[model samples]
Each structure stands twice: as structure tokens, then as C-alpha cells.
Target: MPPVSQAPNPTPLYPWGVPPSPPEKSRVGLMAGIIGGVFLLIVALLATLVLVGKKIDSSYPPAESTLTAPGTLLDGHYKLAKDDSPTLGPSLEKSWRLSWDAKAVHGVVVAYHPSGGDRGELIVTGMYGRFRNTGEVRSRVLAGNGSRHTEVKVIVAPMDVTPSGSRIRVSCEEVTRSWADGKALSYPVCAWADGNTWARVAYMTVYTARSLDLESAARITLQIRSEMVKPIK
Candidate 1:
């Protein structure tokens, strides 16, 4: 009997010609890893921001100091005398005598009574008598070292005195702009007050400027308030 011819073994297929197994499982795992990494990164960044905000909050202290000087009275009776310019410029020059009744209205009185003006122009023209019963006033707060000084921006609100009584309350907001740091800063001593015939008082808040510290701002505010006196009544 003729030996049955063995069927030629099928040639092994080349691996290169075979379709590769789909990497579906690996792809799934890789995606999961990428997503987890992004989530973790975001959480870390948020935590960092929280820590930074807390640090800033902790830096400023409360403003408890009273601005009213002892023995100072605000009963609407006093005199104003013109004084030489403290710093030389075009600003009107004047001082005060305790005898004048601080109620009479004058152009200078009306001008400085409100809370807006140019520093150079303020020196020359005095304060403008725009009389802002509403809106806000911008004031300067002093900060930084003696050699390197900075200005802090402050906002003051007008008060309602009454018919025949001239009374205004200036409130300082915690928000502040800085000339030195080129950024806005906030502080805890965020509130301050100056009313007619009353001591100026400052209230602290929970924020402060990065460049212009709260203390510096308060000092500058005090100086500005001191310069302000109502015309003799």
C-alpha cells in the first residue's frame, strides 16, 4: 500500500502579518492614571492657595486706637487763622484759633470739607467744595521706611450732619491701593472714622496690603485727618 502522503504542515504565519492584540486594558489603565494625576494636582494647588490666603490673613492686626485727642472738643465753636505753608507750594495757607465758631461757610471751607482733590492742586486750590453727600472720598495713607516711603489708598464715606449742624463721618475701608508695590493691599485695621468735633477712631479688619502694612496706612490717615479742621463756626 502506498504510504499516505503526509499533508504538508501549514507554514507558520509570520507574527508581523498577524493583527496585534488590541491594547484596550492597557489603554484604560493609562487613562485612569492620567486622570488621577490631574485630580491630585488640582487638589494640591487649591491647598496651596488656601495656605497662602491664611498666611496673609494672619499678618494684620486690629485697629483699636482712638483718633480723638484728649481735651479736644467738637461743639461747633472755634477760630481758623491762616498759617504759612507747612510745605512750600501753591496750596492755601491757614491754621486755627480756638476762639472762632467753626460753623460759617467759606469757599475754602466748602472745598476742604469734602474729601476729593489733587495733592498739588490741593496745595494750591485747597480742597474742592464739591460736597459729596453720597459716594466716597480718596485719602492717602503713609507707609514704608523713612528713606523709602509708600502711599496707601483709602476710601472715606460722608456723614449726615443735619439742618444747621455741620457733621461728617469719614469711614476708612479695608481695601487699599499701593503706590510702591503697584498692587492693592487690604488690612485688618480696615475701618476708621472721623466725624465733626469728635476724635478720629479706626477699626481693624481681617485684611491688609502686602506692600503697605496696616500700621503705616493708619499713620498716614491720622496725619491727613490732623491737617483737616473745620472752618470757624
Candidate 2:
């Protein structure tokens, strides 16, 4: 006869069954971390490559002691006003100095006041250096100027023969124009590389209203180089 049977503990129905399992962790944060790490690694690798390239470029042989800018060129028509100046200024930023990386560099700013004193003050800036590859240096030097202020025409033509009728290792010319006092002025930039020496020349004159001749500027550069770069005996 026994007491009434105790009701069995009621079990939870489907909706209230055992406690739900813990939620799975999200992988978004992990994935993002991995991607960031990879990107940083790639950037570091690129930086290392650039450093190696710069080191190789600077590993060229020592420059000859005699390689320098002369005091005078073109029969004293151009006189050296400054030698090895601390900086080349904005004009150089548009030309060789931007891309010029060499073992040794010599810079000179020449002043030209014609006998008649009618042409105003003409300046020639020359940059000489020692490098490994003539073509590479020449190309870099020319590319530095790019298309800035070059509205007339973009000329990067090869100069097979110089004024002396002798073949040059590598030569090129770039022409650009600018306005001064409501007058258009021209700048003829030239680059020449030979042996282990590289040179860049630029013509600037605010007094003259006429455009400068490219061929003549290139010839003058050659003359300047000839006088400056002497045999390393």
C-alpha cells in the first residue's frame, strides 16, 4: 500500500534541454592579424632590396683625384664663379642632382658675361662625378629633369658625334622653357658619360629672351668635360 510514488523529476523539454554549448570563437581577428603580418613582411623586404640596390650603385671604384671642374671653358667665355658649392639649388633638383648617386661629385657654377655685356648674366652649372655604368648614369641624369617646364619639345636624342668629331660614350640633350618678366626663356640640359666619369650641364639666362640652342649647349658641355677630366697618370 505504500505511500504515493514520488513523481519523477521532470526532464527539460526540447526548448529547455541541456545547456547550450559555448559559442565558437570568431576567426576574423586572427585572419586580420595574419594579413597584417604578411603586409609588414613584404614592406620590409622591399626596403631591404632598395638598400641593397643603393649599396651596389655606390660600390664603384674610387674616382680619380684629377676629375674636377675647370676654372675656365670656351676660351674664358665661361668662368667658374663657385667651386664645389654646398648645394645646387632648385634648378639641380630638376636635373642631375636629383638622381645623381656616385662615389665622388664635383659641382661648379660658371658665369658668362659676353664682351658686349648685352646678353645679361648667363650661368652654366656643371656636375661631374664618378660612376660605374655610363648608360645607366646618363639615363638617370636625363630622367631627373622629366617634363617640367618643357613646353617647347622633349628632346632626348643621341649625340653620336661631338664638336671634335669624336665618338662619345653616351650623350643626350633635354630642352625646357620658362618665362621671366613676361618673356619665354629656354634651358638646354645635357648629360655625358665616358669611361668612369659622368657630367651634366645646364644653361640658364634670364636676360635673353631667345631660346638657347641644344646642340651648342651639348658641345659646350663636351668642352668643359674635356678640360676638367684629365688623364689619371
Give the whole-model CA lDDT for all candidates, comma-separated. Answer: 0.33, 0.59
Q: Which residue pairs collide, candidate 2?
A: none
1-233 in candidate 1: lDDT tens per residue? 99899999888788468887876668788899999999999999999999997765444222222222212211221112232224421232122112122111112311111122211101111222212122122221111111132353334332222223223333333333355556443442222222222222222222223343444544544444454544433
lDDT of candidate model 1 versus the reference: 0.33
lDDT (tens digit, per residue) of candidate 2 on 16-61: 6678789876799889999999999999999999999888776765
* RMSD, candidate 1, Å: 19.6
- Against the true structure, whose lDDT is highest? 2
Q: Output the number of the TM-score-best candidate.
A: 2
